[model samples]
Target: MISLTNLSYYLGSRALYENASMHIKPGQKIGLIGLNGTGKSTLLRLIMGEYQLDGGTISKAGDVTIGFLNQDLLSYQTDDSILSVAMQAFERQNHLQKRIDGLLHEMEVNYRDELVDKLARAQDEFAALDGYTIQSKAEEILEGLGFSTDDLHQPLRSFSGGWRMRVMLAKLLLQKPSLLMLDEPTNHLDLPSIVWVEKYILNYEGAVIVVSHDREFLDNVVDSIVEVSGAKLNYYSGNYSFYLEEKALRNEIQQGAYENQQAKIRQTERFIERFKAKATKAKQAQSRVKMLEKMDRVDAVIDENARVNFRFNFSTQPGRHILHLDDVTKNYGEKKILTHANARLERGDHVALIGANGRGKSTLLRIIAGTEPTTKGERRLGHNVSFSFYAQHQLESLNVEDNMLEELKSANPTKSEAELRTVLGCFLFSGDDVFKKIKVLSGGEKSRVALAKVLLSQANFLLLDEPTNHLDMQSVNILIQALDQYEGTFVVVSHDRYFVSQIANKIWYIEDEQIKEYPGTYDEYEWWMEERKANPVDTKTAAPQASSNSNGKLADKSEHNNSNGSVNGKKPVSANDEERKEWQRALKKATQQSEEFEQKIAGLEKQIKQLEAEMASPVVVADGKKMQAKTADYQRLKTQLDSVQEQWEDAMLEAEKLEKKLG
Candidate 1:
């Protein structure tokens, strides 16, 4: 457990935390959330001792161990083999094991009793730490993050930045510290790795605090929500989704009180202004004016103004035939990155390219974007095709010396200063901000600036590689809204499920080096997953691990620590009776606001039923236009109703399970 007692931090004239008090109990998963540049990362760094507090103190109950996965981990790279780096944590034990082995050899040769005793003590310590499971744990953690057996010996330099982040994650998991602080940890991870991290955190002992823009990720993995704003921290005893609904309701209530107070003040001011000039009620007027002047005005809180709405603008209409790939083969020496892959992309298609990390998702995106070529296949871009590529590693493309304005103009020559600045403003680049050099921007700022450039490209087709990286929640919402309205084609490789759900109309799932298409959003992909689970596929045997896992077979999940202080394989939480109880308790707390989530869901359900009944009624059939309108209304209602229904069911089950536990 960890505790913060009247902790305060100041940067120049601004105080980040003013006597902030917080408590984190064991077995609790906390989500740290706030607007960008609100010092969420700084607070974590303060706890991690990367920074010093200007006032107050952060108290600790005993020896506390902390591990952090910061955004600057991209620099952790080397030509050294992967396993060697992973085994570095066990150096002391390894050295002891080696010394014991040498001692045993010497004892056998010289018959020394002292060497035997030392060897016995070393073996005992090693066994106590679960040394036997070290290899299994290392392999499981690495593979869960999408490293292959062959990749085990590969040098760190072989990986890209995103993959390097995975390596950093592996190192932290290997350390197994008591307090794990992850700031936007999911930024560079693929879905598979994200899921693995979620599971690992769910089961991890001690406490976890993750800062992420992925709403669903935070909602599923975290138990408490810590909202830092206005130089203080407010704790909500639930996940991000729960925090959102609660905060919204609380704000609405506060707004009402503020409005009422303002109205009273206004009335008193009006009465005093009119009555002050008249001798008839001069005494009363003086008292009224005094009350108005002395009253402490209730300041209505306003939302953060930093949210922006920049989006890609498309000009050329996509051709019916957008792209074609036939018998494509891409290989790195003997290791095949892609093998005999074939696919076609049509105009106005919104596709998601999914696979385990390092399975060539970005490679295929680049190939489609025409950045590179396949070894044995033909790739074709149709006529009138104009596309933009948002690189997974975009920083490499930016010239550090170039200012924000220069960077935008360099991406596309046709953009005007006025037009470019107008668009850049949406990403919070304004006035002198546009003149700031790209190298001077922070990671989040650079990410937004890169995305701003993509929007100004005016391409009809977008090929994005993890486009949501470094974006805040508000920025992501703005982008999602833009994508929903834009009449363009997109092939986005992203791990943010919420982002994909809002805009993706089709999917191209890449697994085992093959691509499969689905006609709906990413949610439908889950149906495909369930089907595959019901009809299991033996991927290792069926395709020899050469082709992709098309059906997305059920992956085995397991967890254990080796005798030598190493965690074994990872596993998903099964939500048995006990686990379900925790979920229910959280749900119960979430539903206590004035406008209960259950009531909203019920109201929506009623509306949907009414709309369905009316649309189905024979009377509407007589008027073709009216019938069509009714049908459309019915469909819209059904979608909303379905979403509400899912939420309702989850909350009810969780509540029921917790109620029982409490009883």
Candidate 2:
């Protein structure tokens, strides 16, 4: 167990934690939450001994091992293969294997009994640690974090910085320390990977403390919440949802007690003031004054400025049908994403697009916003349906040279500086912060700025991709409130279930190259799912009734297939014949694309191999310019190869689906 007993920590002259006490018993998953700059990361550092305590003690069991996921990506070995780095988690097992090998060599050379005994002991230790399964286990964790099988063999330096962090996280999980403390672990992860982390943490046996802005992640994984604010700690014995409910009740109770205490103090003060000069009442007045002084004062609860106040303003109302997708298909080269997917959105419909990572949730949003083109079929936006698209990397799109005020001003040139500053203040930026350059802001601050820009867009439709990616709980609630009251349509892709539940009146579940629509809130959809799962008999027979139509609208398969086939009262081309022709054309196209992608991928791979060989050659190493040129070519080819490979995989899936239909 790890315990913090009346601990105090400081950031310069500011007290981040003062007389804060908490305990982490075995298997307890605690979520550390606070506003930005409230020392959530600092407290974790203090626990890890990266910072010295200003006062008090943090005691832990002697055998305790801590695994902290620091934000720094520079700590991992970039020169090593991803798999090799992950396998380093089993350092003790590696040592045991080495000892066993040494003992075997000794036994062969000298034929000694001592060598045999040493070998036996080493082998036992190796088996005890499950050394043989270490590599597989490491790979499993890495795969869960969104790494491909091919990625495992690639050098860490080949990947981008965000992916490299995932490699570090994979290593940390493999280590399985006594305490697992993650600071914003989901920052770089996609929705699927975040879901995987949630499951992994829930099943984790060690004590866990996560510092995150993801409310759904906390709700799913953590059983306790430790809120750090105003140099104090407030503990809740439940998840984020429960914490909110309980905290509100507790605060209300505190307010009531404080009000009652203030009333008594006021009455006593009035009595003392009225009788202090009267000789008959002097003694009683004196007694009352002493009583007042001795009484334990009930301090008024201080409610922080925890939420941003704003509304999403729109210039015009959209037509009833906000957007429509008819037989829409999206693919990169041969890699198919959405295949014949259809959907329609009506005005005032707040839909959530949810699916696994790389399954085209964001891609679909991009398609609808006209930022990306559809590979096949059509997409139509309703009249007056102007949208503001907020991509996950919207912060990166900001001009680094521009200040926060300038960025907001760019969004709304007509708005005055005072008006822009007011909006920025709503997003927690004011005074000097508004003057700060966009480049120097932290992830949370940048996210707020991006949100502020979106708020100023005043578009009637919002296409937001992972808007809550770097926001705090408070900011999330603020956005939720804004969207809840907004009179516009939106299709937001977020892994935040709470935020989605709050805003989404309809859900578009994209899975298996198709979209499924559910008419109702996320909660209702979940309950319906649970009810279906509970009755296996009903579930088995319900599949045919729930298939989607040409427009991706939910319908009875029998009725939809028969009625929707005949358009404009014309006798439709035989459904099977049309389907067969389409599939045949798709198959031929996919096969040709797949072959072309294969050739490109092969060429790129060959080039990469040749470059690696040349880089390893002594002659090339001796020439810096030659080596640099080869390395650059190698990186460029590798990136192209990755894209081609993705396309090839998509083509293969499309081909398979076509073949199955043809058969």
Candidate 3:
């Protein structure tokens, strides 16, 4: 365990932490959260002794060991395989194994009793340390962090920065130090990897302190929240969601106390002003002045939540079909990214494309944007459709010499300076901050500028590839709000679950070399996926009788059968007349049931929307009891809606199978 006592740290003349105190307990999972530049990562370094604290103490037990996983480790390079790198954590066992090998080698040459005795002792220690299973342990950890078994043998220098970072993380986890410190661990992770890490951290035996902006990751992994604000560390004894609710209540009480203190001060000042000149009340007035001077002033609460208020508009209204891909085939050398994949994007569609790494999400985005050529396919854009693509690499396309304001001006030459400034302000660049040159901005700052430019592109269709990268929680929330209010169609690729859930109404994933669609929110899609995993469907047996042709039209099965009742060189059995009649009756009943389920689903959706509106009402929000009741009601309705939706989908599938059989 480690404890920071009255910690005070400064960067030049600016104080990053002033009298910030936090005691990390054994086996505790803590999340360090704050706005960018608030020194969340800096605190971790201070604890690691990389930086000298300006004041106070960081004390830990002499036996305690620490393992830090940071961005700086991304530059690590070696020819050794990642498996070897990770197995290096077992230093004692490795040394013992080497000793055992040396003793055995000596005995082979000299046949000495001493060598045999030494070899026996070394082997015993190695076995006690579980050295024999070290390689397997390293492999499991590396693969859990998203590496393939084959990738474990690749040279560490052969991987990219992000993948290398994962290797370093695997090494640290294998170390099993007393205290684990991770800075932005999820930044390079995919959704599945992130989930894996969360589960791993939850069951870890050691203490953990993570600095991350990922809300859902924090909610799932951390048991306590430590917020850095106003040069001090504020502790919350619960997860991120609990911190938000507790902070709200604390701010409400603080605001009231501040107002009351202000009122009291004003009254005392007025009394002093009126009675100071009078002979009878002069002493009392002077006493009251001292009391006013000595009173502790209550600090007003600072609102950290920022809202996006600018309107995102385009000049043209797109046609009903925004884009279409027919039998699209894309390949890079021997790698097949997409093979005969067909998909359509319509007007007003908000889609989130997500999956594990190397699924070609960005490649698909570029293909949709018409920037990447297809090996064999047709991509058609609807009438009046204008589009803009945003990605992390686009940051390099920015003019570093230009200031943020000038960059926005270049993005939209028609918008007035005032309008551009307002847009920048919504992105947290206000007043003179907008005058800073792009070259001087940090990665997060550059990301905000690029996002602002994309919003101002005046395109009805947007393709965003990892737009949430390098953004803080507040910035992510602001982008979500803007996207929520946007009427234009968009397909975004992101690994941030909370951001995707908030902005996207539809979910898309690549499976079996084809783009698959789920007509629901990310949360709903996740639930459906879980259901499928729990009760997996066998696609080989579930294939429908009718299939789509290259033109995306349904091909009749009868066309493939001969008049002699032979299909594809196989004999077809004929059903009895009564059986035929029974099949027809069943198909009719299934179709009607499917139709009824659709109507019920529609009604449930309407009711859920009404409940959402009610929960958002000002009156309900102001009353704690009423708000709680409304929230409970909303959750209940959502659960019901999910059940009904599942039922409806099953009914439709059943109807489809019956129809296919009859045809």
Candidate 4:
């Protein structure tokens, strides 16, 4: 729907985009990605016409509508309820509703035919526009973005900045513009909300251009990738994973070309140097020199991946048991965060504490660090267990007047200046960058500095809270590598799935006011969670217990059961056999019913699509009677589709329950 050709933009003397060209086709999902300061957000503003382009043109269809969700919307405040704010997207319907209200009020006094006709026309138009269901649609989008139904009626000004950003996102989604641009949309969302948004974007009919550092989110939603690098917009035909492989191959080819070019130049220069003194070959040498000078040079590939070369070591090794929480009960006033929660951390445990927002992940991390007191619990640390807590607020603890090098020195006075500088360089702060004052650094820069100090603290146990916030993909990789190499135990709270998957060997989540542990990698954990969802059981009564296998690793108790109705070594009784047969029959019946319903739902959906197309035909539109008749048929098919979908859902749930019971 929009095309940018030979675009050039500059910030004073620095060129952000030079002759960059990109075409956004209709119904395309594009993920715009780059390291910080590569002009991703600036490009969004350039598209939105907030900034004047120095050169080239950005052309769009005259009727193309655009909706942009950016960080700037965080400052928007109003006394209207969030529901009302979201429903404001239906401008025409809202205005018509107001006029209808005015006409109806006039009818109470005058009762004229004109007023009655106006009200009838307005009502007809409202029904045709689906104005009556606008509020319900707004509410659905808002709730899908993580707002509770009760919170929808609250004043927009009462919410926090992140929540307000979600409200703006909901409003934009409701508007359903032809082209949507979102800047770091996942930054304000939790894991569940992010998943919801991914599904929504996958089914969205309009074009989408999203700027994000979230790899999994991009991989799941976008059909194409756009990399803003070296003042050019580079296109990739696939998602983030494909882009990584493709970029690596391209870099290999470029590096080889660059090397061959350099070698040729060196050989030519040597020839000129050796032959220029001889009178016979001087003319030939001059020609060779000119040829070398006129040759187009190949640009060397710049490696952007930052590596963590410095080893993270602790002064003292902790005991096998690093920490233990026994019957931990934590509360904030009337809110119960944790109730009788028990967990243990060993010296080698690499745990990821994850859940939705406001589930006490950070609070639990602080409690583990012994910085926050519990309502009723005992938190104990093992021998030689030195712990360091890292949180966003720790950035504020840094002395603003001190330079980065000085800050690291303050964190550990014993480390030599060379050692400190080496650590800083690993964090992408090289040479004179260490001399910059902390006050002048950006949020991501400050985060890197804080992370560097945390690594230098020489603590055997680390409690990290949202450590990946404000970090780019490369910086997150650096932190992941550093954590992977560290010999100490750590528990981190982060929403970045890629980082968590890279660093964590164990997963921890809060459910039913208690900490639950899953002993596996993130990918395995996700598979297990999906299986659990498909075969859901009552978690309160049938929680899976961890058991040790022959390899001495933790495995689920269900894995220990034998195939022939035996657990451990005992066989089931005759009564149990009859019960199993009954369950088997029930499962078979349920599966059959579910399959039948799915087929019916598919048929109804197909009929609905056909009716919709028929109703939209020019022949039907030209004849009012035919158009009305087709619309009625379309509505009838739509109602049938809805009913069939509900029944299919019920059948699926029933089949799942039966499967769970049989298992």
| RMSD for each of the candidates | 19.0, 18.1, 11.6, 23.6
Greater-lDDT candidate between 1 and 3: 3
Full candidate order by lDDT, most accurate first: 3, 4, 2, 1
lDDT of 2 by residue, 1-663 (tens): 998999998767888989999899999999999998888999999899989998999999999999999777545556889999888889999899888888787778789887788888888889999998998999899999998898899999888766888888888899999999998888778767988998999999999999998888899999999999778888999998999899889989989999999999999999999999999999999999999999998778877545545555764445456777767788888768887777777778898887566678878888887778645777787654688988867778999999999998899887889888878877777688889998898888888888888878988888998898768877787788778887888889877777888999887776567766777788987786667778655432333224244233445445434455753222443457778898899999999998997788777767777787888899989999998988888778767765777677678758956775576
TM-score quality measure for candidate 1: 0.75
Q: How much lDDT does each candidate structure score?
A: 0.75, 0.82, 0.86, 0.85
Residues 480-581 of candidate 1: C-alpha lDDT, one tens digit per residue = 766776677788888899998888877766656566556677887777677777878874333212222222232222223323333221223334687766
lDDT of 2: 0.82
TM-scores for all candidates?
A: 0.75, 0.75, 0.82, 0.80
Off by over 4 Å in 2: 74-81, 99-118, 143-151, 154-163, 188-199, 268-296, 304-309, 373-376, 400-403, 416-422, 429-440, 528-663
Reference-based lDDT, residue 399, model 2: 94
* Tens-digit per-residue lDDT, 1-663, candidate 4: 799999999988899999999999999999998887889999999999999999999999998999999989999999999999998899999999999899988999999888888899999999999999999999999999888888999999999888999999998999999999999888788899999999999999999999887899999999899999999999999999999999999999999999999998999999999999999999999999889888999999999998888898875545556777876898899888988777878768999988887789989988887788645887888655799999998899999999999999998898898999889988888879889999999888999999988989999999898888777788888999999999999999888888889999888888888888877788888888898889988864333543211111455556447556665333433347778888778878877886887787677667877876787799998999999888888788767755665565556656755665565
Candidate 3 C-alpha lDDT tens digits along 392-481: 889999999999989999989989999999999889988799999999999999999999999999999999998988788889989998
Candidate with better lDDT, 1 vs 4:
4
Report the candidate with higher lDDT, 2 versus 4: 4
Question: What global local distance difference test value does model 1 have?
Answer: 0.75
> CA shift at 456, candidate 2, in angstroms?
1.7
